[model samples]
Target: MEARERVVKMGALKHHSIVRRILTLVVSMVILIALVNSAVINTMIYRQLLTEYKSKGIAISQSIADSASDILLFRDPATIQSLLDQHLTINGVAYLVLEDAENNIVAHTFVPQVPQALRTIYAGKRTTTATTAFHRLPGLGNVYEISQPILFGEIGIIHVGMSLKPIHHSMLKVVAILIPILLVVLITALFVFRSRLRFVTRPLVELADYTKHLAGHNFEQSLPEQGAIRAIAAEHNDEVGRLSETIVSLEDAIMTYIGDLKRTTAAKQKIESELMIARQIQLGMLPKSTDNTAFETVKIASYLEPAREVGGDFFDFINVGEDVYIVAGDVSGKGVSAAIFMATTMMLIKAKAQEHIPPQELMVSVNNQLIALNENMLFVTVFCGKINRYTGIFSYVNAGHPAPFIKRKNEALEIPLTGGMALGVDYHHYYQQRELQLENNDTICLYTDGISEAMDVAQNQYTEARLAQCIGQSKAVSAHELMDDILQDVRIFSDGADQSDDITVLLASWCHASASVSSELGVHFTNDLSEIAKLHQVVDIYSQANGLTKTLQHNLKLVLEELIANTISYGYRDHEIHDIKVFFTVVNNALNMRIEDDGIPFNPLEDAPEVDHSLSLEDMPVGGLGIHIVKNFVDTIHYERQDHLNVVEFTKSLGETA
Candidate 1:
């Protein structure tokens, strides 16, 4: 209902816009003017005609009075009456009467003149000439009554009355001719004015329409081209033309701005995506905290938090024989530059630590290499050391970094770290070797300045004393728990202050070596793929017995089908009996699977060609998806040619890697 009302109102507005209302106003004004003019002219003409008729009556009465002087003096009314009768023959002249000055009827036409017995027999006025007045006599129409002095009121007044019919008829004739011509002129004027109005308003209306179209994004109708818009500009050099040109200019400017905005938005989104990917890759490079883990010969945990998406803090661990190496480092500055330096430094440290090199000696080699490759002259502070898990011999190098704290399980006293020259500061600087024999329950907490120098909302640094106190209070907590408690305390102390630098903590202790753990499940099945049921039963029993999650069981089932199916489907050249062996082990906090089949030598890892994920389903190749799924679920894959057996083994860490 409202829509209908709106449509009606809009239609009215549309009709009214194009000179329709203006034309109505013009026509109304013209008709009013014509009627007023006609009325005024007719009134003036009627008055003038009445005046002339009165004057004629006066003259005729005077003439009759002059000639009737002799008759009236002798009192003979016959001659006087004959003179009055002659005047009555004229058209529109109803009657003429000659009466005595005493108002006695003397002569009259069409009726007998009243005698002195009448009501107004002698209504008199003293005048030298004729005087006239109007009268509406019953059945005689409108008439004029005039009287004049005959022989200076001596002979008797000669009264002459004339009807107004002739004047009214003449006035009617004039109006009859004027009205039709006025109507025709008015109609023609309306048409001409409306046509002229359209020319002036058409461009403006179209400009409004086009502007609305652009704003509404209603592109069903094609927009006018530049040439067409320019035509409007050239057609009239008025405001409408200027407006049209302005609309065209605005359209171009708006479109250009929108396009630039889209491009800028897309580029920003792309940069954000790359930064997200860089953050994942960076975090993945650092080892996860693992003090809760019961393996690795010690309880070592690490937490590296960046102020930004990427930061320059790093931590590492390596197990060689009965010794565990722990390292924590910070690159100079922060953000991207520091992150790059941190990555390079981590690679170099891991490479050297794997060789079982001494900490001080390893720092010497790492520092020189950094100086040679450090075109930006960046420096790094590192605290790297090795701890004998059994003998509790802690040996380390402190390179321009904060001291590593040694807190005993039962003592509150804090051991401060020693300082030396920072790496990349000199090409041949030898790092200091410091050894502190730790007791069985002593803990070593290595850190970057980001922790000791961390600021709260009040701009107060956490300070080395605070870290020592926190560790002392939390001394009985596990290594991972202690790290978490320190972080939580710092977070609460900061009171939501943003982490302004890279905060890294590498915690380790040569307390007790975790008891070794291992799980093995092997099932033997024939060549038939349906015999896979026996393999599934073997894995399910082992998984339930070891408290493995249901999810792992399902994943292992799919793994069995993919790995064993490949062997059964393609390993054999004939329909003959073949053996497939599948086994699983839980060792060193990791789940390891080894599949050995007496099939052709096929390394699934290297043989599985890379898949193009960008391809559509119809265009994507189908066979290697199962292998890809297995890799996604598993952390590591190893393929070895053990004699005639194709041994495919993979391991997934149950906790952080050492």
Candidate 2:
């Protein structure tokens, strides 16, 4: 702890005072080196001064010795003394002395004698060779003296003293002048280096404080503005400046991230609340799993589970009129929006189914409603069917959803769910209804894509083939057991992976109670007279297959022709296309013919005139002949008005003769 405190304190102090020490060390060392170099230069200059003065002194002494050599050899001192006197007054020449080989002074340049500081220097070297030496002259600060043997003389010694007055004194004067100036310059440099310290340390100190705030998670702290620190950072292209800029950038990122986090958190809460409510509403819209709503001859089982809190998958079964409608579908999204679309779609299906609407027309109307209301471009794929409880005929329309699987005791496979795009694509789109006559113990399995697309941890799908195979194994089971087993298999296939979509499955089993079988063949025709030949062809085929005689076939053809001709003539008022449907069915060897027309409402069974046998042929009504003949060919005739259209049904027993 102590060590750490020291380090922290050092770091804090380093922000302010670190550069001062560096500059002090560098500037102090530079000033000290300058002073040392000046001293060294002064010494070299003094030495050079001494050497020049000594050389001049030696030359003067040699001139004196050369002049005295000839005179002293002849004992002529008078001329030597005159030469000495002439050179004595020259600068830095303290003395000039010449002696004979007998030790007798011949000439001297000094006025009296050697100075006290120069006496020992003059006597220091007595060799015959020349030599120079420095000595302290009493009045002069320093001097150099040289002694030489005059080579021009026979046997004479010369001694010269050169005072180092001007050169040495000038060098000393320079040292005295430079020491104070150098002290002033060093002080000024220290002040300048100290004042510039803020430029380098201010950013570092600001960054230190900023980092401390960040370390404490104090996100609310305001950073330095465009003040001194910022300006310094901008001006100075250094490590401290770059670090400060980076800190400012980090602060902006953190601020932005915090704002986004708050918004995201609030949005998440709102969505979760809405999803909770929507989930309840969506689940409530479906039929309860405990409520197995089915007729005695038909058993039903369904399951719906959402991947999200609310899902787009839904299934419903409603009893409308004499038929039961089962709807299984999926909308194109997830969560709240998808759940809303699913609920809307289901409600529409139920409303139309209650009116005994056929699946094709029901799909078209539902699609148009969705398209009109869908501002979000939402769509649904639905498989809705109407099951005739008494006859076990399943009529359904596939509106871009997955096709239902028809599993009997013998076969299991998927049929194509063709016709019509997904809802909300186009209001004018057409959907076709298909009919599947269910035998005993036949199961219709309707589902959404969730079943086949259920994935494993490895992302392998539980495909349609696998679903079919699983259902095939459970073909003999009850509807509830079959659905349970299939769901369990799906769970196994998932391998603990989370569901990615809404899984919905509806199983409806149908078994006809009666032993006799029924079959229907239908024919569609336009208003053209040429199409009547196709009606005739249907009549002959049904007649031969059901063991009807040729006469009965002819009579049936005539009855159909009269009904179709009446519909084509009077049913539609405008010049437009119309569909007239004729159904021929054999039930327990009884021929049942049902004709439907999308035309003006007219009950032919009630409006046909009773033939008047008492009148002559010319007095009878023309239209009564065809109706009268049709009334006699069949045992019973029935008529009903539905949807502004007409339905005519007739039945004939197999044992009846023509």
Q: Indicate which candidate wins on lDDT.
A: 2
- Writing each residue's lDDT as its tens digit, candidate 1 over 1-658 gives 5754555455446646657777878888998999998999899999898778877787777777778777888887676667777878866667776667675667778565443322253355445567776776666778777877678876677767788888989998988888988989888887888887887777765665566557655333336555666688889889989988888877777777777888899999998788778778889998776547432347887888888878888888876655688998989998778888988998898888888888988999999889888999889988888987656788888888877787787454544455678888898996778787887656788888888888998899999888888888884567787788889888888888877887888888665322211266565667787667655655565565566677777777777778788778787777779888777788888888888888878888778867887999898987887678777777788889899998989886655422
Please list the C-alpha lDDT of all candidates, in the order they appear: 0.76, 0.77
Query: Which ranges in model 1 have alpha carbons more than 4 Å from their true place?
Result: 1-16, 36-172, 216-226, 290-297, 300-302, 391-393, 404-415, 437-658
**In lDDT terms, how accurate is model 1?**
0.76
Q: Report lDDT (Cα) of residue 112, candidate 1.
A: 51
lDDT of 2: 0.77
Measured by TM-score, how close is model 1 to the native structure?
A: 0.64
Expressed as tens digits, the lDDT of each residue in 348-459 for candidate 2 is 8888887788899999999999998899998999998878765788898999988889888856766656576888888889888888788777888998999999999999
